[model samples]
Each structure stands twice: as structure tokens, then as C-alpha cells.
Target chain A: MSELHLEISKVGIDFPTPKGPFCALQDVNLKISKGEFVSLIGHSGCGKSTVLNIVAGLYQATTGGVMLNGREVNEPGPERAVVFQNHSLLPWLTAYQNIELGVKRVFRGKKTKAEMREWIEHNLELVHMTHAMHKRPDEISGGMKQRVGIARALAMEPEILLMDEPFGALDALTRAHLQDSLMEIQTALGNTVIMITHDVDEAVLLSDRIVMMTNGPSATVGEILDVKLARPRNRLELADDPEYNGYRTAVLRFLYEKQKKVEPIAPKRAEKAAEKDSSKQVA
Target chain B: MSESTTVIPTVSSAKAASKFPTALVSKISPAKLRDIVLGTCLPILGLVFFLLFWHVGAQHIKTSLGTFPGPKEVVTQWNNLVAEQKDEYAREAAFYERQEKRNAEALKEDPNAEIKVREYNGRPTFFNKIQTSLFTVLSGFILATVIAIPMGIVIGLSQSLYRAFNPVIQIFKPVSPLAWLPLITLVVSSVYVSEDPMFSKSFIISMLTVTLCSMWPTMINTAVGVAGVSKDLINVSRVLRLDWLTHVRKIVIPSSIPMMFTGLRLSLGIAWMVLIAAEMLAQNPGLGKFVWDEFQNGSSDSLGRICVAVLTIGVIGFGLDRTLLAIQGYVNWDKSAVVR
Candidate 1:
């Protein structure tokens, strides 16, 4: 394997609730190498976003911590750029200006005025959003706005990109288009990325490794699958490939047959129901 | 023979239509015509009907001075006020010219003569009173905005500060301008003593009263606006690790602008209303005072002039609100969003 770039060790977080402390995650551990694309996939409420948030330094883990390039991650920084679900583009700023904001923040004393402008234009070109560069977020379509969001995160030249369901709000076609763009960009840049997603196909299509999480009330990594697909993958050709189908079935079996989703009944009610079943068996 | 005659008439009609630009007529669909009638024509018609009602109603109600002034009499009074303002300007110009001539003559006669140029102490015309009221109201509004917006931002950003200040804001919000006028008057009279006072006591009193009564809406609305910034944007700020001032400037101010403008418009409306009331009660030299003085004059023309002032006040208030609305629309980035 390559050099260890990021590490999540003994991570757990307990949120204070009216019912006392509720553990959302516990003993979650993962090690990622440089230039690796990792996807965290699980059922809803599985604390997949929680793990990404912890890595992004937006949330502090109660037990352990996240390390980036051998430094403890405590607070958010421009080096760890996040592409949020809703695009999170400032409505008041144009697409180009939104990218400019992060670029200016990251490249302020390092890049000259013309260099920054060229860099901003290049990132927009990378996402194929140079045409709508001057349009505000409200004026653009949802998919276009998400493209700008990606461009903004890319323009920062971050060490690691964090995406929390970046395409969840988009239509299926738009999602596919964005996924293709993301793959192209990732291949070209070789940037480290950690994305949270619910779509199994999306996880398999993009990730170097998929980290499947268990259902929460203390959710942790259930399994990790390494995809050894060749680079420069074509989704159409891979659809008919036997190896691709094998990997897809493996993930499906793990999600449905092995770690099946259960209805979250209250603890006391579950206990009482279990007692009734055992008593009936005794009778 | 009948078909040939009908074709000839149609050709002539077509020629006529081509000469007159028939595209405009063709463009007005039934819906477009209805919009024109409802949007433009109906408002004009309503105003005409209102004038007619007032003209008829004025003759039947006899007031203490005389019959209430009708539209015709109000128009005459408006013209008279304009002429009076012109005369006042001419007098002011003549006063300055005479002072210059006298000073030059004295300097020529005694090479070191001390000459004094006196200010024109003429009675303020109707237009002058309008200017005074505008100036006072604007000054009060600006003063309030400068103090309220920053304070509101701070209070909104902090939970404990909001808790501490909320009761005080609520208590003072509803206090009337009239209630504050006497206290403001007394305070200005005592605290503002000087050898040559920069502002009149009545002006200060009216302005302070306007400020006190009008500032609450802006402060409260701004606080609400600042507190209600969307969580997604806040997360973006956190992820960016924006500094405190940068966060406030980039995220807080832009998102809260629409609500802040709403507060500003409301405050301005209240400020205008409070200034007039304060001016009237305090006998300050403004349109309010003019109306009060005309009522006390008990002359036949006085009622008509008072009617003119009333109309002018309503028009000015409407104009001020429209101006603020235009400004709000300009500053707001979401052009598709209707500001009102």
C-alpha cells in the first residue's frame, strides 16, 4: 500500500439527549492512503454523515480523533474542503464568485491576482460550468449549482475533499452526470476524497474501497470491500462484466441478507416482547 | 357585382390599417386589456370618484371657519402657497444683495468699516416647512439605524444577551411618540445649553422623540433576522473556518439583508409619522405646525390651505415608502424574489 494519509482511530461520539447520553458511533476505525477514493455507505440513520463530519473537523469525536497527514484534526480548515448536500453556495454570489471566495482564502498571498483568476476559471472549466460563471445560485439549475459546489471545493486545492451526499438532492440523470464528472476529476487530480452516500452503485462505481456501516444505536464499520477494477473505467462496458456483477452482488448480500435493517423499536418495548416470546416457549 | 364591391372595401380597410400600425391593436389580448383596466385605468378612476365624493361632501358639512374646502379651493390654496414660496425666495435674494451693496459702500467710505450681514428672518413658506420636516425625519431615522443594527446583531448572536435585552425592547417598543415628547423637550432644554445653540430646542425635542419611537421595530426585526440565518450556510462558514468578522460580513449581513430592509422600511414609516405628531404638539416649524396654525387661524382660506398640507403629507409619505422599496429591490440579490 501507499503512505498512510488519513486515519480514524477509536472514534465514538455520544450526543446529549433528554433521555441521557445516546451513543451514535463507537470504536469506528479506518486508515486511508494518499490519492484513495473512499465511500461510506449504509442505511439511513447509520451515522455515515457523522463519520464524515468528524473527519472534516466539523464535529469532535467523544472517544478518539481524526488525523490528517499525522496532525490531529480539531477544527475545520481550508485544506479540508467540504462539498455539502444542498450545494451550500452563497445565494448572493455568482458561481464564479463562490469559487473565488474559497480560492482567495486558500491562495491569498501565494497566488497573484491573475493567477487566482486563471485558477478560478480553470476549476469552472473542469466542472464544465464556465458558461454559467456569472449567474447566481438561484438563477442556475440544481445540477448546475452542485457543479459549482464541486468546483468551489476543487478550486481550494484541498489535501482531502469531504462530500456529504453531494448528489442526493439531484435527479438520477443529473446524479449520473455528476458522478462521471467527479470520476474524471478525481482521475486527473489524484486527490484524496471521502464521500458519504446511500446508493450502492454509486459507492461501487467511484470508490477505491467501500466502507459499509451498520445501523446505528452505536453504528460502526460493518465491512470494507476493496474494488480492484482497472483505471479509466467505462460504466457501460462494466455493466456486462462478470467481476462487476460479482462485486455488486456481494454488496447487496451484505446489505440485505447479512446486516438487515430492522425497525427501531424502543428498548423497553423490545425487552417486554422478548420476555413474552420466551414465556410462551416455556409454556 | 356585390363580391367585387366587398373586396374593394376590404382592400381600402387594409390600406388604412397599414397606415395606422395595427400591430399594437393586435397585441392587446382580452387578458392584456383587462390588466390595463385593472392596473392603470381603475386607479385613476378611483381617484376621480374620490375627488367627486369629497367635492360633493364638502358643501353639506359647515365647519366653524366656513364650509369645508373642496377640491377647487384646495387647488387654489396650493397655487397660493407656491406663489408665496417664490416671493419668499425673491425676498431672500434681495436681502443678500442689499447687504452686499451696503458693506461695499461702507468699505469704500471708511477703509475699515465693520459691516454686519443679517440673516433673512422672513416667515417660512409652505415649501420651507416641508423641507424642515424632511430633514428632521431623515436625521432621526439615520441616527436610529446607526445605533440599532449593530446592537441587534450582537444581541441576536448571543443567547444570554438576547435574554437580557428582550424585556427592555418589548417594554419600550409600544411607547407612543407623544408620550416621549415632553420628556425629550425637558431634557433638550436642560442639557443642551450653549452660548449659541446649534439647533433649536423644538427641533431637538421633535427629533429625539422621533428616534425613540421609531428605533424599536428596526432593532427587533434585525435581531430576528440575524438569529434566523440558515444552518447550512453556518456549516459552510464553519467548514471554511472563516474568521469572526469575515463570517459576519460574508454570511450574516447578506442573508439578513431582506429582513433588515423590512425593519428599515417599517422604522422609516414610524419615524415620519412620529416626527409630524411631535412637530404638531411641540409647535416646531414644519408642515405639522403649519396645519395646526392654519386650524387656529379661523379664516375661510385657512381650511383650504390645511387641506393642501394634509394632501402633501400623504403624498410625501407614500413617496418615501416607494423610495425605500426601490432601494431594497436594488440591494437584494435574488431579483426574482418579490421584495414586498
Candidate 2:
């Protein structure tokens, strides 16, 4: 019971591409305790987003699936909400309405009209987006839209929150502000979060532990570094702290130099010849 | 850049004043004004110039049949025709009333009999032609929508079904409504055969033509729309683990709505235009028929009457297209300039 809220046991993803069945993820195993913020950091196409997508059930793993709270994860449900890289808020909806949509879908029968409005507004305010709640995704800045997306997902009150580079589209300053907001929100809600990003700095700032992934077409967890920085960490203050640099340096070394230890292979050609084995998870 | 350099802090422009217009014209740029004025200007000018040319050309007309009516003469003829129609109705009413009285007198012995006149009347009046055309256009548009949307969804969902249907669609899409009209007319007439041959069969031809011609755009566009729904959006639906109905209602339709509306609008315009052309070919009892009948008359007034019919078709077609476009705008969620 005390082990982890989320568990991935030897998960692999091999998908058929035009070239062949290419391997995206390779023999990756990880665990997240309840309320832990875990970030996957790696170079582009290292399958960090693919891992997050698998957790989100946007895709499935070839060898393994995720288990949440000791139950095997099969399908996507509202209990697991996603924040996409592009902040895929339904552009047609206002911020309040977007959050309301998630709320209404998740909490269908119990809440009264006033209660629903209060819930939506409360989440919007949590993301510091109460004032811009009426704005559509296009009318507001990219950062604001992502805040709305975060609010919308959290408002669903999912058991696990999966974010796939939710702030990649925003400018640096805005990204920093959101990072703080996200950390505060995570601390308050105690959500079991698995966020994927290429930004090593973002990962170091936000995650309780950072999982650095190897370069793909066959990728795996190369290293896991604990972020031993103190709580309620301020971005600029943490940047100046020497401990943050130590963790960042470890991640950088693993990403740039230590990646050479993993062997790379052509994954597609193998999958095609073995297509008769229908159980192969072409995720 | 050089001319506008001095105007930085001023409320008014400090440019060479002659290059710009007075206060009123300068308020909105000439380019913007041109856009507004151009919308109405060319059509009005064309009408005026056409009338002038016709009026001059009318003088040279020495036809074997009779003198052709000028635009002014046509306006006078139209007024006289209105008067003649009123008189005709009055006479016809009086004639009907007398006939009714005679029938009533004769019906002293036969009260169960149907009302019968000496001649067949109620052939479509001029206004009735336009009304029937409008009715047929709208009804056919609705029918096309009913068949196309679901079919499009099916095709969009299945690769094999899409492949199977592709050849059928391709073959039918380019075939003109005129080609379909006779096939439609003959089939309806034979299959819908009745004791009295009461069905016009023209109605069937017009409706079928509308369906055939309009179906392609709606089918193709709706399939494309459904296919183009974002993968990320679908993932949200999946993670929410939505039911099939919920996926369609919450995600699929909303995402595909803009494209669906585009399909509907395109098909409607196509149906409206095609119905008229189809009617003309099939000799259907519609505005197209009215024009054909007018053209067949060997009189100088025929072309002028044809001109009126042509004008009405254009106006009605424009009105329908605008109405559909308005609906498209209303239904579309991504109303901003950008889709993504």
C-alpha cells in the first residue's frame, strides 16, 4: 500500500511507421508515490511524450501497461486528465466554460448550478486565471490558455494528472510563472503528476525526482536523479542555489554523455517479420 | 516611409496634403472605401450600361415577327401585364362564379359529385413558378443533408468502406443533373405509376437531381471533416474513456463542425443551381420551365420576359447562398480567422 500511486513495469512501445515498426520506448520501469511530481527529461524524440501519452492512454505500451493504485490501467477515464503540449483547450469555449465542461463531465449528477460555478471559479482562481476566465483561448495569451488548460484538467479532480509539455508554447518568463503556479497547485492538491518535458531547467525546478530518458528509436530510462531542493522553492532563488546546479549538471551529463552507453537498433523491420504474433502491442 | 516620417506625434497627418483626400475620404483609406463601393458599384453600373445599350439596340430591331421592346418599353409592358393579370383574374372569378351557380343548379339532384370545370386551369402563375422553384430547392437541400451527413460519417470511420464507396462517388459526382433527370423521370414515372397518372414525375426528377448533384460535396467534406479531428482531442476523449455516443457528441461533431458546415453550405448552393438546370432539361413545372416556355414564344417580348426570369433566378440563388452562409457562420465554433 505504501509503495507508489503509479507503477510502470518494463513498458515498451513499438509502433509501425513508414520505414518499419519503430521502437519508441524500451524497457522503461518507474514508480510515482502519491502526490509526487515526476518529470521525464531528455532530448527530442526520446519518447518522454510517448511515455506520458501511454500513461494518459493516448497510446498503449508494447510490453506493459500502467497500474494505478494497484489496478491495471486499461482505458482512459476522466479519473486521469491530460494537459497537452499545445494546451488543447477547445478554442470554441471560454475559460470558465472549458473548466465547466470538464467539471460537468466528471461530476455529472451531484453538483447544483451554483456549486458548479463556484468549483470552476475556484479552480480558475487557483491557476491565477479568474480575471481572464471569460476569454477564449485565442483572445488570451498562450500562457493564460495553458493556465486554463491546467485549471480544466485539475477541476476534473483526477487521481493522476498527466501533463505533456503543457508550457512549451509559452515564452520563458511566462513559463517560469506557470512553473511556480503548477508547483503551488501540486503541493496544495497533492496530485500524483507525471509531466514530460525537454526543458531540463523546468524539470529540475518542479519535479520531486527527474527521470532522464535515453535517445531513441529505442529509448529507456537512463538515470533517475532526486531533486533534494527544499519545498516552497522560488524560481530565481532556487536558480541561485548551488544544489539546483548539482542536480541540473547530473541530468545534463546523463542526457549528453551517458546516453552513449545504450545501444540503438532498427526496430521496425523486426516487428514486420514478426507480425503473426498478434499480441505484439503496436502502440 | 519617407512621406509619413513627420506625422509621429500629430493627431492629423503631416504628409503632403494633396496626395491625400479631404477629411471625409481620408478617414477610411481609399482601399477600404473601394472594397465597400466595389461591392455594389459594378453590378449597378453594369445594369445601367446594359439598359442604355439595349435601349439603343432596340431602335435597330426590325424583326420578321415584330418590333423588339426597349428596356423602357419592357417596363411599360410589365405594368400593362400586371393590369391585364388583375383583369384576367376578375374575369376568371366571374366566370367561375357563373359556372358554380350553374353547377349548383344542376347539383339539385347530384350532391355527392366532385367539382368539375369546363377546362383545366390553375396552371402555375408567374409568381407561382418562382415559389415552386424556391420550395423545390429548399426541400431538395434538406433531403441531401439527410442522406449525406451519416453516410459521410460512416465513410470517414472505415477505410474499406471509404475505398468501396470512392469509385461509386467518383462515377456519380461528375455526371450532370441533366443526365440524371431523364433517368430519374422515367424511373419515377414507371415505378410510381398510378391509375390516373397523377404524379407530375417532374417533381421526382427535380428532387432526385438535387440529391444527386448536391450529395458529393456534403459527403466528401463531411468525411474530410471527420477524418481531420485532432489526435490530441481524441486522446482526451479516450482518457475520459468516453462512450461512443459521448465521443461523437462531445468531441467528434464539435471538432468536425466547421468542416461539416462547409459541406452543408457547398451542397446547398450546388443543389439550388443544379435543380434549375435539371428542371430545364426535364421540362419540370418550375421557373426553369417558365423560362423555356417563354423562350419558345416567337415574339419580341420573349427575350425581355426571359431577362426578368434570369434576373429572378440570380436574385433567388444569391439570397439562398447568403442564407446558408449565415447558417454556416452561426453553427461554426472556430469563427476566428484561424482554425487550429
Clashing pairs for model 1 are: none
Quote the positional error of residue B58 for candidate 2 in Å.
9.2
Candidates' DockQ values?
Answer: 0.42, 0.53
Output the TM-score of candidate 1. Answer: 0.89
lDDT of 2 by residue, B251-316 (tens): 777877778877887888888889888778777788888788877886767766766677678888
Report the CAPRI category for model 2.
medium
lDDT of 2 at B22: 42
Candidate 2 residue pairs in backbone clash: A21-A268, A76-B239, A77-B239
lDDT tens digits, residues A25-135, model 2? Answer: 889999888888899988766778778867876666888889988988766777789998888877777899878877887878889889999999999999999899898
For residues B1-340, what per-residue lDDT tens digits would candidate 1 score against the true structure? 3333343457776556644555455467779888987999888999999999999999999988889889999999999999999899999999999999999999999998998979989998899899999999998999999988998888877767989999999999999988898888888888999999888888888888888988888898888888878877877887777778988888888898888998999999999989889999988899989998988887889999999999999999999899999998999887887976
Give each model's clash number.
Answer: 0, 3
Please state the CAPRI-style docking class of candidate 1: acceptable
DockQ of 2: 0.53
